[model samples]
Target: MKGPLFYSKILLFGEYGIIKDSKGLSIPYSFYNGALKNDGNASEAALNSNQSLKRFASYLKDIDQDLVRFDIDKLTDDVNAGMYFDSSIPQGYGVGSSGALVAAIYDQYAFDKITVLENLTREKLLKLKQIFSAMESFFHGKSSGLDPLNSYLSIPILINSKDNIEATGIPAQQSDGKGAVFLIDSGIIGETAPMVSLFMENMKQEGFRNMLKNQFIKHTDACVDDFLKGDIKSLFKNTKQLSKIVLNHFKPMIPQQFHELWKKGIDTNAYYLKLCGSGGGGYILGFTEDFEKAKKALSAHKLEVVYNF
Candidate 1:
C-alpha cells in the first residue's frame, strides 16, 4: 500500500526572523519527497519506521479531538500491517523530512482533512496551519507548521507575519541567467530543537534583540520584497546584508568549518551564504550574482542550484 507523496520545503527567506513576526517565503522543493508505503516486508528500516509510526499514531490519538481528529483506527490497522514511510528527503537537513511525513499522515488519515484541490481560503489555511502545528510538534519541540503546510500544498507560501500567511507565486526562473540561488551541502546534520533553543537564549539579550529587529529582520523583509518584485539588484544587495548579519550574530548556529567560507563570500562578493534552516550544520543556502564565479570559488563543495534569475 502506498499513499500520496508530500514534497520537502525550503524557507527561502525569514529563517529565525519569522519567529519574531518578520516576513517569510517558503517554496516546495520537489527534488525530494516522501510517501507512506507497506510492502509486508519486515526489514530493519521498515520495522523501525513502523515502530516510529506507532509512537506517532499514539501521539496523534492523544491530541484533543476538537482541535484535530484523525482516523485512528485506520492508522492503527496500517501500522499493524507493517506500513512505513518511504522517503528520499534528508532528515535534519532543514528541508522538512519529518514535515513531509506529517503531511502525508494527515492527508491520508485526518478526518475532515483539507483537500489540496479545494479552494483554500484564509480561514482554511489558518485551520490547516493550526492542525499541522499540533501534529508536527511531535517532531520539533515547537513548530510553526509552515513545513507541513508547504509540503501539503505543494506551492509557494508567503508569510506576512506570525498570524498572516497565504499561497503566493514567485518570479519566473531564468534558466540561462547568471545569477542563481543554490544549496551548499555542509555534509553534516543539524538538530532543530537545540538550534532553536540557542536562538531563544540569544533573544534574551537586549543587544541581540535590537540587531534582530533593526538589521536582520529589516534585511530579510527587503530580500523577500525584492525577490517577489523581480528586483534582482535590490534582492542581492539585501541578501548580502542579511548574510553578513547572520554570520556575525548567528555564529553558533553555523557549523564551525564554514566560518571562513561564509566570510569569504562577503569579502569576495562571489556568493552570500545564509542558514537554510536552524543551521548548526546541514545545507547552507547561497545566493550569487554570478553562478559560474561562485561555483569556481567554492570548487571543493557540492552545490545544488534551486533557482536562477
Candidate 2:
C-alpha cells in the first residue's frame, strides 16, 4: 500500500542558531519528496530502506507512551511484507530527507494523529512538535523536531522562539526578479550529529557564546524578520554579516574547499553563503541580489535556485 507523500523541508533561516532559541523559518520544498510503498523489487536502496524502517518502528515502540502511540503490529507486518520508503530526497543534504520519512511513517501508522485539516492552535502545534521531536530523535541523538513538523504540515513554519512557533506565510516569489536564493551543491555529504557536536563543544567557550549572541543570532533573527516583511534590501545586509560570523567562528562545520568561496561572496557581494544545515558539506545556501552575477561567480559549481526576490 502507498501512503500519502511527505515533502522535504528547507530551514530558510535559523540553522544552528535555533538551538539557542533564535527565531527560525522553515518551508516545505516540494521539489523532492517521499512516500511509503510496497517494495516490488529487491533493489539495494529499497532493501536498505525496508531494513531501516524496521529499526525505526522498533524505536517508536520504545518512545514514551504519553507522547504518541503507533500501530506497531501493523507497521511491523507492513515491513515484513516488504514495505519500504521510496524517495528522491537526497540524504545528508540538509534538506530534511529523514524528516520526510518520519512524516510519512507518522501519517500512516500513528494512532490518534493530528490532522492538518484541523484548526492548528499554538498548543496543538507545540504538541505536534514535541511528538515529532521525540520521534525524530531516534535518527539524530537530539532533535528540535522542526524538520519533520515542516514536512508533515507541508507549510511554512515560523519559530518565534523555543516555546513559541506558528504557521507563517513568506513573501511571494517574484517571477522575474533578479535577486534570488539558491542552493550550491557541496558535492560532499554532511552528517548533522558531528556538526552539532562541534557546535556544542565550541559553546563551552565564553568567546563562542558571546559571538553567538552578539553576532550570529542577532543577524539571524534580523534576517528572518526582514525576509518575512518583504524587505529584500535589509535581508541581504543582515545575511552578509551572518555569513561573516559563520566563516569566522564556525569554521569546523564548513568544508575546507568552500572557505574561499564563502568569503568571496561576502567580499564581492555576488552572493552570501551560509550553512544550509550543519555546513560540513552537503548544500551551501546562497543569497544574491543578481542571480546572473552569482551564477557567473560560482560557475565551476552546481547551483539550484530555490527562491527569487
lDDT of 2 by residue, 1-309 (tens): 888999988898999999999999999989999999994869999999999999998899898898899999999999999999999999899999889998898899899999999999999999999999998998889999999999999999999999999999998999899999899988999999999998999999999999998999999999999999998889999999999999999888889999999999999999999999877888889999999999999999988888999
- Cα deviation at 127, candidate 2, in Å, is 0.6
- lDDT string, candidate 1, 1-309, tens digits: 889899999999999999999999999999999999998877887788899999999999999899888999999999998999988898999999988999999999988888999999988998999999999999998999999999999999999998899999999999999999999999999999999999999999999999999999999999999999999999989999998999999999899999999999999999999999899987899999999999999999999999998
TM-score of each: 0.99, 0.99
- For every model shown, the clashing-pair count is 0, 0
Name the lDDT value of residue 127 in candidate 2.
Answer: 93
Query: Scored by CA lDDT, what does every candidate get?
Result: 0.94, 0.92
Q: Model 2, residue 32: displacement in angstroms?
A: 0.7
In model 2, what are the clashing residue pairs, if there are any?
A: none
Error of 2 at 56 (Å): 0.7
